[model samples]
Target chain A: MKSNLELVNDCDQFPPNRDPSFLYRFMVNGFDCPFGYLLEATVNTFSWPDYWEINHDGKTVKLLGSSLEERNKQIHDTLLAERERGSFKILKGWTSEIFSVYGPQKDLVLSIPRIAAPLFGIVTYGVQLLAYQSDTSDGAIRIWIARRAKTKRTYPSMLDSTVGGSLPTGETPFECLIRESAEEASFPEELTRTKAKACGTVNYVCRTDERGGGELGLFTPEVQFTYEMELPKDVIPTPGDNEAEEITLMRVEQIKSALGKGEFTPANGCIVLDFFIRHGIINFENEKDYIEISSRLHRTHAFPTA
Target chain B: MKSNLELVNDCDQFPPNRDPSFLYRFMVNGFDCPFGYLLEATVNTFSWPDYWEINHDGKTVKLLGSSLEERNKQIHDTLLAERERGSFKILKGWTSEIFSVYGPQKDLVLSIPRIAAPLFGIVTYGVQLLAYQSDTSDGAIRIWIARRAKTKRTYPSMLDSTVGGSLPTGETPFECLIRESAEEASFPEELTRTKAKACGTVNYVCRTDERGGGELGLFTPEVQFTYEMELPKDVIPTPGDNEAEEITLMRVEQIKSALGKGEFTPANGCIVLDFFIRHGIINFENEKDYIEISSRLHRTHAFPTA
Candidate 1:
């Protein structure tokens, strides 16, 4: 069985050989308020369009547009052109959705197409909800777990949190959670809004794997707003969309076993481990790596974040 | 009012001018497994006792002792000599307690006297418990808060968690929590052992401030094991020792006001914030720095920890 710390490290893989020299800071303001990390290959291969500036000496990339609108258009046009020419395979997964990027002052610097986020190693935000119900007789807690549909592009047929989705350009994490809960888990909006508690967040800087369906070495720094909802046993969640193939209630021990067997997606495993820690199932006496596991779930990064 | 992010930043003060060049790594096991950070001034001023070597070129400090026993003795003897000579004012607060240090592999590196830890910028561990109860009529939560005795050396007269203490060399966080619950809060050992739930941990690399009662700019990387207990309404906590001057139950709103007013110790403020976040009193919609505050509470550091 994998140790809890190993499970966390798998999600937050900071490679020992990750060379800082090959990274270009994604600068927004005149100061070094970096929002993303651009690889040397990415900087060298991309044709420098009119609004983009690359400082070779400083290893920094900046948008030269005078306004946010122009900056957004500059990225949109460049990625659209890349998709049209089939220059970068990553653009093929474009969903036409945009993600808001923030600078040091917490101002929205610009929005980038969802497919192009990993290309610049931008920080992406998401919401994940772990819906559980109590077994009143035994006083045990059982969580609602979802299995992604085999037809899904990433982590297909793998276990996931009950509800999860990326935040749209202007959506708050709470708003995103409400929408995803209804779409993915057939949960009532009122039920979710009233009961779901924003527990905390899980953060990681992961290098995209083959399962992520992206270019290798793509840096994906992510912040996942985590929530927990205790559902009445009668209000069972059914799959409401193709995102999930099936949903089931899992006891704590079963979830632990699945986590050890690597059945859940890396990010989902981290969320589950965090849930267990907060619920006092996996604790100091039971897990030797308790402190390390808890701390690693909220890893810090160099870039600016919202 | 101070924002939630500001409360977190107050505890995790990573100065902009923190220079890596002036810091020396504590090396062990033929690798760069640093257990502490040594400032240049600390390196230059300290007399190099036997079994201790300073590599000026590499900016590294290593213990040349053949075994852990010898390494422990080397540090003990050096600090004892410094104390006798009245060389460092920090030695005045020595409690004769030792804190266990760990290497990269989580192996026990060595133990250092408590007061000498910050001088070497070593990682320290502690246990903090927030005991609370629910208002039967409204279902509102009220937490037991303690004011540190004015006679206390550190953070005197400031608010603190219900039960807290530093982890001694051989004590587990759970054991320490149990002991502190009895000594600091006058709670029965059995009640604490059965009721307290290990929520998670809060980590930060903080520079010592005036209230810390140490030399300025002392790097104190800390990991606090946090736990929470739901107490029955009839059972109120009373001050059992001189560590606390008073114990009172405060509603969530009152706690928030106090937190904003900076009535709590820096570390205790962090613990309270963590409690509020976990209990859902602080949510994504209510706090603008939701993700930033949650992630910052579990800040990552370079030094090895247990």
Candidate 2:
């Protein structure tokens, strides 16, 4: 069986040999607020737009649009042009939904198309909720697991958390969790609002490879605000949207088996492992990599966060 | 009120201006396994014992003793001599207990006196248990807080976790927690063993200043195996030993106020802040530094851990 640490390593693949010189810092507001990294190749070959400035000496790239709306339009036009030229396959999954980019002081710098985030090596945010039921008699816990629809663009047909979604530009994590709960799993809004407990966050710096269905070698630092909801026994979750194909309640052992067999999405695997650690299921006594796994789940990002 | 992040920064004072060249890597078994960092001043000025080798060119230091016993003895004798000379104030609080030093692959390389751990800039392990009670009707949570004895050497009369103790060389975290739970709080072994849940770990790299009651400018990277226990309302904790002078149950708001006022021990403050975050008392929407605090609580240590 694959160790929990191994499962974590599979997702948090920040290249160890990454060279700072080979990547350009994504600066905002004329300050040294670096929030993303852009590959040298992209900097050299991509068609130059008037609003983007590349500084060779400083190894930095900045948007020169003077205002948020102007910057957003500049990026949108650039990506649209790139899509027409078929320059990057990742742009094929264009998510018009914008993701807010924050500066070093947690100020909203600008918003860009969601799919374009990885190209700029920007940090993204999401929310995930693990809904479970407790059998009070024996104290056995069963979790509700969802399988992504085969038609989904990313990680299609993969096992996922019961309720998970990306945080749109202005939405808070809790708000996203509530919306995802109803939209993805048909979970009641009142039940989720009252019962969902915001536990903590899970952070990892991942690089997209071919397996991730993106342009390879792009950094995607993510912060996931995690939550847990103890569902009542009488409540059942069904597929509320086409995003999920099915929902099933699995015992802890079954979940562990699935995790060991690498059946879950990489990030979801990390979220579930974190859940196991917090609930005392996988602890220092039994898990040799308990310390390493716990620390690795919350890696300190090199760049500023929202 | 001090921000939670500011409270965290108080305990995790890893010198931002730390010059790595001024520190020597502690090697083991002829490998470049750097488990600790020793200041160059200590290397150049201290009396050289035959068992310790300083490689100036490689910027490394190693224990030349052939066996674990020999290595342990070498460290013990050196510390004893230093204590006699009154060379380091940290040696005054020397506990006879030994802490295991691990290599890069997590193998036990040697054992050193507990108090001498910071002298070598080694990573130390401890277990902290936060005992709490939940009101069934209103769902209000209250925590049991401990106050150290006024005569204690380190942070005397300061607030502390309900049960906490260092991990001796040969003991696991859980084993240490169980022993400390009974010895420190007069808590029953059965209740602890059955109810204590190993939630996760909190890690930080701190440097001792005058306020910490140790030799100034010594590095202390620590890993705390944190636990949570829901105590029965009828059960009360009394001082089982002189380490803790008194124990009292404080509501969550009271604990937060204490944390804001910096009444708890620095490390204990971090542990309590972690508890608040995990229990949803401190969350993303309400706290501005939610992501930063969550990630900082589990800082990635720069050395190997056992």
Candidate 3:
């Protein structure tokens, strides 16, 4: 009997009838437990170093790399070749180069393609800012949204928030918000750091890179720290980088229609839902799952048990 | 592999080395699918009636009662007897005589013991209101908190919010708030119905009532709609009933200290945490799990598909 919380979290995203044994916990040093899972097929082909143990008896494999440097280099090259081979399309410009290695208490940042994260079931974090007009005579909220450039390998030309980007290694979520605002929207640091209120986040997991086929892919879990920044009535976002095709202000109703049409990234839709709830645009009486949807956006697996 | 959402929702409340099969789904009429799971031991004993079938092949059971009235009565009597037999301890004053039957769409209300809900894995909803000072000089918030009456059946003498109650049969949540506020805190209707803003909810499932012995209990899933009401600095909460021994104003720091000492009920602790996050008292930078905790309070299983 799974908890209601777990059932909601599951979202029926996993393929039914999948064998649990097909995946093994991807354990890192000092984690005592796995942060994520690695496919058994991948493990069978790994030429482990003498120090690393393939503990089949314990029904678990240990990545006792000769050193952190050695492990990073191998995982990096392996995933990079897979990407170059067209195994999984990587979103250019939007890609996070520094991947996170989650330990028991703290996380380690290594220079690796973010697209390669799921191989070890490692987690990722990002920032999505909802820049909007603060005053509207009609009591309607208008948000500045961007459309990803068509050149993007994934979700190209999809609608996104005013500003968004993956969290670079060693940057705080707030700092990332400031940097991303400047890169994506050409916003000044003062307006972003001062007026951008830290709202919350929307998180979910997706089964990634199925190019290896049946029962083989990386599990990518993500957490995005969200912000709500007010834009001066006359201010408009001009793209500072080529990542966005266009940035424009749209009424909440228009955005809602776009969401219904699936014009936004699934994650972006969830963030807008959070936005509606926070801005008093949605209430429990109107949406039965209002509470459920609001809370589900913030579930954190950033720290997995050992 | 579960979605990161479900993984975060799980929070692994179960004991180590626990068997997943110990739990079974709790289905209702037309819900053909599982609402949640009950302990397997409870299901093996039911000589299910004609309309209902125990689908051992699917490793689940179905509840297809002829009518809500009939099903409600059966589950009610069966659980009441279990309680009388001392299978588990009942909270003295907090027993819910009215039971809730949630289907795919709307929920049905029936007269049944609320405490018996977990035995069948039913999910319940309640309203909790936070009455606070309208103005604060130091930006330090003060709230009106109540201490439960010592003579109450469940969680006697524990700390609670200013006003809280189960949603009565046929009452809207807002109506329930107005009603409960008057009943619990002698709050004025005009003040509550007009000023009390529905914030959101905090949801979780816990295995309470340790009839299985030593850490094992029936899982109770709950969703509480939280509210924030502003009170003039001169106003005070006078208990309208015996539910609380005292209702007094306490600084947020005092509540935090009480939470640290475990003086508040487990559920109240969660409600307060939600309050802190919403009020901007807790920030993502300060609390590592702040965003995670903030979002998890609202995961709902209301619309489980058949």
Choose the strongest candidate by lDDT: 2
lDDT comparison, 2 vs 3, better candidate: 2
Considering just chain B, what TM-score does every model have?
Answer: 0.95, 0.93, 0.81
Candidate 2 residue-wise lDDT, B1-306, digit = tens: 888999889888873224467688877655566888888876775676977888999888888887878887888898899988888878888777888888767777888888888889899999999999996456889899999999986789889999998888778898889899999989889999999999999988778887768678888899999999999988898889889999999988888888898889889999999999898999999999998899889887767777
Listed in order, each prediction's TM-score against the native is 0.95, 0.95, 0.77
- Give Cα distance to truth, residue B126, candidate 1, Å: 0.5
- The interface root-mean-square deviation of each model, in the order shown, is 1.2, 0.7, 4.4
Q: Please, what are the lDDT tens digits per residue for candidate 1 over residues A179-258? A: 99999999999999899998989988888888877678878899889999999978989989899999999988899999
Q: Which scores higher on DockQ, 1 or 3?
A: 1
Clashes of 1: 0
lDDT of 2 by residue, A34-146 (tens): 87888777677568687788898888888887777887788889889998888888888886688998876887777889988988989999999999988656688889999
Model 1 misplacement above 4 A: A15-19, A29-31, B15-19, B28-31
lDDT of 3 by residue, B1-306 (tens): 322223334432442223556566666665555676667766764545555667665666665666778877666665555555555444222355665655555556334466556566666678898889847888567999999998875678989988988775567778999988988998888888777877666676656643223224667667777888879877788999999999988998788778766677767777777677665566577766655455565444432411
DockQ-based CAPRI category assigned to the predicted complex of candidate 2: high
Q: Which rank order by DockQ, best down to worst?
A: 2, 1, 3
lDDT of 3: 0.66
Q: State residue A289's C-alpha deviation in candidate 2, in Å.
A: 0.7
Candidate 2 root-mean-square deviation in Å = 2.1
Clashing pairs in 2: none
